[model samples]
Every structure is written in C-alpha cells, then in structure tokens.
Target: MRVSANLGFLYADQPVTGRIASAARDGFDAVEFHWPYDVPPEQLRAALTAGGIQGVSINTRRGNLDAGDFGLAAVPGREDEARAGIAEAVDYAARAGLSAVHVMAGRAEGEAAGRIFVENLRFACEQAERHGITMLIEPLNLRDVPGYFLTGTDHARRIVAAVGHPTLRIMYDVYHMQIMQGDHVRTLQGLGDLVGHIQIASVPDRTEPDRGEVDIRWLLDQIAYSGLVGAEYHPTRAPGDWLRDFRSSS
Candidate 1:
C-alpha cells in the first residue's frame, strides 16, 4: 500500500527537487524519477537523501528523442547500441541508490525488431544484476507513443516468463493499459509476480487520479488485498491535493 509519486512530469513544472520531497512528505511514501540520466544522479541522490524519500525507479534508455532514437531496446539489429545505453542507466541508478531501472522499450517493430528487443533485453537484465537493480520493462501506449513496440500485457508476461529471470519484470502502467487493452485487474492477476512495478494516470487524459474514469482508490484496494506494492505513480494538478484522498485501507 505504499505510494510512490511519479516525478517525471512533476519535476518539469517544479524544478527544485526539494519541492518533490515536500510533496512526498505530504502523503506519498516514496518518489520516482522518469529518467535520472537526464539530470545529474548525485544531485537527485542528494535531494532524496535530504528529503528522506526513495527514488523508486526511472527510465534507463529513453533515446535523445529530439535526436530521433525514442529508446534502445527495440531497434532492429542494434543490440550493442541498446546495451551501451542500459549500462549507463544501471550506473546512474546504482549511484543514485534507486531500487529499479525502468527499461524504455523502443517503438520500432516487425519480426526482426522483436528478436533484437528480446536479445537486448536479456543482456540488459544480466547487466542489471551486477548493480543489484531490478529491471522493469515499460510498455507505452501507441496513442501517446506511436510506433513504439512492446505494447501488450499478455505478450510482455510471456516475454518475462520466457526470459525466466527474477530481476526482469513489467512496469505495468494503468493508463497505457486502458488505452492498449482493458481489464487492468485481470491483466495483473494473470501476470502474477512477473509485474515488478506499476504507474497509473487517469485514462484518456493522463492526469490526476480522480480526473479520469478509473476508480484508483478501488484499484489500490485491490492491489493491497493482493499483497503487491502499488505506487500512485502519476502527474496531477496539485500533487498533494490529489494524494489527500487515498485511504490506505480503502
């Protein structure tokens, strides 16, 4: 029932890292960064240490988007390139004392692309073990990330099972799941422990928890009852205000 705030977009509007700590203090138990490599890892580590918070996870391979690389995992025939990116991500997360590395799966596709992604992902997972970091492969929705590969929960579950590694798991985002597929609860139930972490934003809008049609309080209850640690990972108009409504036992 611990709630980890998503600082990816939150930090964009509130650049000062301490402000994020204050938000977490308001109610959240921990915080997450989108891509810590984009910022100085030491600076973020200092902020987290000062604020008494935990940086749950962040993206390990978001390509220089403006540079046209969306990510590293799915580029056809680019295993080495993807591995290099993952190495950096692991280094940053390890230095920052993060618990997980959210692997950014690329939007690239096709049979050859799938092969590359699986190979590169397996390598990344092996590398992450040295850092003592669990790798969570995130699946972005096509609507938000058109052409991005790795968009289905069932398929992702299959991949994790096939890989058969405890450290490699899925970063199942509820918002993206609603868009790419339905039955969020069922999907998680199916995945079982293959799911390492979760991110949730309102469906259709990706905003505050209460803003979308999802009854996240109810969802949280389900997750808690199931004995999984579900973070409130999302953006909001007023992060604290949005957090105020969640009852741990609800």
Candidate 2:
C-alpha cells in the first residue's frame, strides 16, 4: 500500500507547513493532517505543491474539545453547527486537492445521536460530492476518547448503510478496531468496499508500528494488495529515524 504520512502525528516538532516537506524528504507517498484551518489554505496548498506530494485526507474541526466536544456531527441540536463545519471542511479539502475528509462524531450518545449522525453524514456527503471529494466516518476506540460517538466497525457500517450515499464511507482505523475488537482480517473482509480510507498505529501505546503486537508489515502488505493505507502513528523517537523504515516502501 502507498503510505501517507499523518503529519499531525509524525512531525509534531515541526511547523505545520514544514511537515509536508519533512514527509517528502522522508520519501512518503502522500500526507494527511488532522486540522489545517490555523494556517491559510493557500500556504498549505503551496507546501503540498512544493513537496510534490498529494494531500490525502483532513479532519473536520472538532468544535471546543476543551469544553468536552470531540466532534459535532452526531450531537443532537447541533445540526446547523455540524453542517457549517462540513461546508468549511469540504471547501478547504476541495481547494487543497485532498482526496478525503473524516467527519468526526463527537461525544453524542444513544438513539437520538445516531439519527443525527446519519442525517449529518448524508448532508456532508451530498455537499462533498459536489466538489468530487469523499466523506469518511471513523470509529474511535473508547480507550482513547471515552465518549466518542462512533466506536465500532459494525456501528459505523450501519450508519453508512443508513446514509446510503456513494460518497459517504468508513475511515477504517486498525488501531481503534483492534482495541474495540480483535478480528482484524475477518472484520476488514466483511466491510469490503465500504472502507474509503485506512489508518494504522500500534495498539496499547500509539507508536510506530515496528514494535507492536500487530503484525504491521503483513497488514501493510494486505492493504497494498487490497486498497489505500495511511501511517497515522506517533513516533517514539526522532521522526527521521522512525520514518527510515517506511521509506523503502514508498
């Protein structure tokens, strides 16, 4: 699989824009980041162009995390706020030439939250499709974010099915899935074409894949043969050294 450097995790020590160049220097195929609104879109676009790398994905703004908001997409009574965020994310991703956008489902819970999640995703997909970009929903494990609305592959699948939009799909994250459920191969096989984007990191401690319980190399090979993959791990050491092992794959 072609690996995209998750700039948000990979180059935490560098300026946001510099992470693009760092990824290029480390021989990454592409790059993805969590939030880019702090920097001008023009600047980010320029960095991507200069680095000669594609920007594969970005996350919608996680409204007021310090106030306990992880995302607004699934929160009831916040449909307008969610839609507005989607609009901004779509506009930025389209203008920046990104391939996908991950719509985070915040701390909302229960039946009402589920309904809101589906509707917001449908609306977001419709909006993103107008710009030829895909919208993704990922299931974050509770260990990392205890109150995250989306937390299992099956739950995410049901939501995607309910939305039934061509542009709306699952952002399958192996790390999260492995935490919530153990059957990776079968789970991935069951999902099939519903997976729009893939992210990976070592479990227990979100670190480089090298020393993890997960056989990341085999997983990478599986993804390479099947679909797209993004390296979204926190480096345990210097970024340069951590990336060296992945350079040859790129």
Candidate 3:
C-alpha cells in the first residue's frame, strides 16, 4: 500500500503550499489535500513537482474549516452547488493531474435529502468522468461530524453501488469507520471492489499509529494484501522515528 499524508491537518504551521514539500521531505510516498481550491492549481502543481511527490487525493470543496462544511454532496436542493463544486474539482484535478477527489456527505438529512442525495451523486459522477477523475465519497462519523448522512460503510457502499459508475467510489476512511463502527477489517473485506481509496488514523485520539488503540501495522498489512493505497497523516513527532517501528519490526 502506498502511503499519503493529508495536508489538511498536518503541516498546519506551514504554508498550505508547502504541504507537498513537507510530505516529500518526511518520506511520504504521496500526499493528499483537503479543500485546496483556495490555492492556485499552477502553484500547487509547482509545489508537487518541486517536492518530488505525487498527490493522492484532494477534496472538492468545503464551507471552510470553521464552518464544518465537510461537503454538501447529498444535501437537499443543492444540485447547483454540487455541480459547481464538481466542475471546479474536475478542472483543478485535470490541471494538477490528480487522480481523485473526496465527495462528502455533509449534513444529516431528512427523507427529502435522500432523493436529492442520489441525484447529486449521479450528477457528480457524470461530471467526474469528463475530467478522468474519480469521485471518492467519504462518510464521516456521527461523533466527530454528528448528523453526517453518509455515516456507515454499508451506506457508502450502497450509495456507490447505486451510482454504478466507474468514476464514483468510496473514500474508505478507517478513522471514522472505527469511531462510528467497530468492524474495520470486516468492512474493508466486504466493501471489496467498491473501495477506491483508503485512509487511516488510530481511534480514540486521532494520533500516530503507535500511540493509538488500533494496530496500525496490522491494518497496513491487511490493506497491503488487499492491494489498496493507504493515504497518510502527520505524526506529532518526526516521521522517521514513527515509521522506524514499522521498518524494524518488519
């Protein structure tokens, strides 16, 4: 499994454009970005090229970090907003030469939201195809995101299945899944072909792999055997030290 770091959280003290550089300097295989539209595509591309790093994924958009707009992919009466978001993401990804974007199920929705959700997904998927990018929809946990409609692996899987398109897939985040649901391994196995990308952070503390309750190495091994790309996170300390545990033990 190739590793990637989410620049959203880590490298907070540095310029957002420096994210890819830091990830490369720290030995990350690739890096992912969250809500990076604010940064110009050419600048981002330049950073990626200079850092000698590849981008794993980038989010379509959000309501800024403070507003907690994880994404409005399934919200009711937001087709235009969703479409605009998709278009922007596709254009950005096309320019950046990125492979995927995380489609989010933002707010908790009522029955009406469900209908709108399907429509929004189909719309987004259709848009994603035009730019050769895959839309990876992520399900946030109720504890962290409380009321996010896409909260479970099964639901995410079902939604992707319903979309039934090549470009739409699930962003299987182990962190949220472990927090919202306990069975990570089972879900990964069950979800199977639908999982387009995977992310991980230890449960309870959202910290480095060794410090958390989940067995990070074991999970990586499982995901590796399954042939999935494992995106990255920042360690509170130097990454070499953190990853040393993995290398020596292996």
lDDT leader: 2
Per-residue lDDT over 129-208 for candidate 3, one digit per residue giving the tens place of the 0 to 100 score = 88778888887878877778888878877777777788888887778778878777777777777788887777777766
> Each prediction's TM-score against the native?
0.90, 0.95, 0.91
* Runs in model 1 lying further than 4 Å from the true structure: 224-236
- Angstrom error of the Cα, residue 17, model 1: value is 2.4
Off by over 4 Å in 2: 223-226, 247-250
Per-residue C-alpha lDDT of model 2 across residues 18-45, encoded as one tens digit per residue: 9999988877889998998898777888
Q: After superposition, how far is residue 141 of candidate 1 from its true place, in Å?
A: 1.2
Model 3 steric clash total: 2
**Candidate 1, residue 84: how far the Cα is off, in Å:** 1.1
Cα shift from native, residue 202, model 1 (Å): 0.9
Q: Candidate 3: deviation at residue 69, Å?
A: 3.5
What TM-score would you give candidate 3 relative to the actual structure? 0.91
For model 1, what is the error of residue 119's alpha carbon versus the real structure, in angstroms, after optimal superposition?
1.4
lDDT of 1 by residue, 183-226 (tens): 87777777777778877777787776665768766775565233
| Candidate 2 clashing pairs, residues 3+ apart or interchain | 1-224, 71-106
